[model samples]
Target: MTSLADTPKAPGALRYTLLINAAPQSSQASKSALRFAESLLQMGHNIERLFFYGDGVLNASSLTVMPQDEINIPAAWHALIEANGLSSVVCVSSAIRRGIVDTAEAQRHELYATSCFTSSEIGGLGQLIEALSNSDRMLSFG
Candidate 1:
């Protein structure tokens, strides 16, 4: 008899994509999603991308201000991406509307280039579609 842990993964590998549609402050969705992804990676799974959309684009904003007592969700994501080399992509339409601007977008829009954190990449819906297509699973948090 083979133990569950000893048995090979039925698909050999598992890849995941994550979509977050909630702001870090008003909801726990962003934090919860990150925690789950971290645990999955520790369990030897692969994370293809973390796509922040809707209000979740705030997670990529460099201008996010929080009280001293609160946990820094964006900082946590930055550390995780830096440490794990994970891909962090924010939806371009959502980000622009939410003031999460990268250098190029800021310049194009003639605004101050100071909103987006370095760990975040501004992308399109196509990125999410690609991730969903390639990954074994796509989990959403709102």
Candidate 2:
């Protein structure tokens, strides 16, 4: 059996940005992101940013309603990102397209995406590109 502890850590500090574009219902993207995040920590790498674009903006939407026994992925990701002090950005264009608006802006615009919805600040693809540029390595999970 392969033991996780037996593996040698990667040398040097690496920075990564995971751009997630897949929906929450899609197991592949989320799973891949989780795995990559774990691996980065294991390898002593830093995550500079986790940018949501296109359909990926859905990951930051607080409007997700899951069953009592089901996992709350967006919350999980948010917690992790906050804990790690990683930059979490959702594309403004994509967010609006999917009806995600921030608390202050939502009330100002009188548009509430959903009952549970809590919006993340809007960003753009350029922010993601900047993350990539700042990081040593950029990995796109979706």
Candidate 3:
């Protein structure tokens, strides 16, 4: 198989949007997506948006308690997003359904607490569509 290092690099910085649809600990998809995003940024590409859908909404949850020996995927994602000032958005419906909510959402739904990370925001699919319209490429992992 062709390794990531063997992949051709873009000639110019391109805008990208990533769609992640797997849970943080459920599969390799979340890790792979993280690595890919890091690689892209390292190569000087711009991530226009990160749209987390389906189970991928779990990556934005601050309530995830990872084992000491395990990688904290959500925390990792938050760090990357914050460090790079990237636009990270979780699907509002998916996040709500999975019990991952921002303060506004929690209040709107009459929930007691907010579980979403500060670096990420709960948004609608319109954000995804806008990202798609503006980005040079869109990659989906799941």
Candidate 4:
């Protein structure tokens, strides 16, 4: 197996912004995005931000419980984000509409609890625009 240290870093490592647009259980988008992010990091490329839009915001839900036989996509994402100290953003509009909320959001909306993972924050399109401006590439998976 090729280890991360064995993988040659790309010259002039590029910064990337990843956009995920599908729900974790509904499709391969989340898995694909995760794999790509791992590859980028292993190759010494910088991920500026992980932007979850549309159904992709589901990936940031802490309440998601996958079957024992299946992989826990959200947990995997959480681990990756934590390990790499990556910036993860779930679109506030999409997240709220889908019932995913951080603590502040939960209080703001007068909900009983927060369901969003701690590693991700509910943000707006402005974050996406800023990420795009700072990164060399923006890739979308769905």
Candidate 5:
């Protein structure tokens, strides 16, 4: 008789692509993203990448000035990404509109300068498209 422990389990792998569409300050989108990423890692799943569209790019910006007592969502994301070697792609158009441009662009346009947008790549819809194509599951958090 074969014991239950003798049975071989099939390998299961999951690749997640997360799309964030909400603003950073007014909603819990960033917080949810971080939690979901952590859980995925803990479960031995893979996070293909995080695509920030519309106001979601705010999650990667380093210049967010939340009240000292308030939680800093952007920083939380930064820490997660840095520690886990996660990929962060920000929509260039949305980022600029939201004042999250890099120093070079800010100098060229005389826009407000911040350190947050500099850490992430400035990309377009194509980046999100690629992420979705490469991932086994696409999750949208808003």
Candidate 6:
């Protein structure tokens, strides 16, 4: 059977930025995207960033509660980004709308800690622009 690891690259392989717009379990979007990212890395390409927009912001939640038998998707993403030192950015506007505050935002709002962990940071749309400018390819797993 073909695997994501077998995906081909042309000459002058490109740098990629993955924009995940779906929740981890909302579909296979995030999971499949992440696995593809891993396969890209295995193939010796660079993922410039992983930008979580829309409902995808939930992947970085530190307070995510999943059943013991279920896969801990957040932790998996956290480990992957950390191990690769990849930039994982969550959309600030979307995150705030979904109650995914950062440490500073939490302190500012006088609320307890939010779901988003330290592995990902809350950033503006400017980061997305920058990622596009820097990356040769933009993959959308929305």
- For all candidates, the clash counts are 0, 0, 0, 0, 2, 2
**Model 3: how far residue 56 lies from native, Å:** 0.6
Instruction: Give me the overall lDDT of model 4.
Output: 0.91
Worst 10 residues of 1 by lDDT: 1-10
As a whole number from 0 to 100, the lDDT of residue 135 in candidate 5 is 92
Which 10 consecutive positions of candidate 6 have the poorest summed lDDT?
A: 1-10
| lDDT (C-alpha, whole model) for all candidates | 0.82, 0.70, 0.91, 0.91, 0.76, 0.85
Q: Pick the candidate with the highest TM-score.
A: 4
lDDT of 6 by residue, 21-56 (tens): 999878988899978988887786888889999999
TM-score of candidate 5 to 2 decimals: 0.83
Q: Residue-wise lDDT of candidate 2 within 35-61, one digit each (tens)? A: 677667666677778887777777787
**Model 2 deviation from native, Cα RMSD in Å:** 5.2
Q: Select the stronger candidate by lDDT from 1 and 5.
A: 1
lDDT of 2 at 3: 27
Residue 29 in candidate 1, Cα distance off native in Å:
1.0
State the weakest 10-residue window (summed lDDT) of model 4.
1-10
**TM-score of each predicted structure versus truth:** 0.88, 0.79, 0.91, 0.92, 0.83, 0.88
- Which 10 consecutive residues of model 2 have the lowest summed lDDT? 1-10
Clashing pairs in 3: none
* Residue 114 lDDT (model 4): 93
lDDT of 4 at 74: 91
Residue-level lDDT of model 1, residues 1-142, one tens digit each, is 1111233444556888999999999888999997897777766677789999999998877777779998788877777776777788999998888788988998999996668888879999999998899899999999
Q: Write the per-residue lDDT of candidate 4 for residues 29-98, one digit (tens) a residue.
A: 8999989988888988888999999999999989999889999989988888888788999999999999
| Candidate 3 least-lDDT 10 residues | 1-10
lDDT-best of 3 and 6: 3
Clashing pairs in 1: none
Question: Tens digit of lDDT per residue, candidate 3, span 1-142?
Answer: 1223233556887999999999988999999999999898878788999999999999998988999999999998988888878899999999998999998998899999999999999999999999999999999999
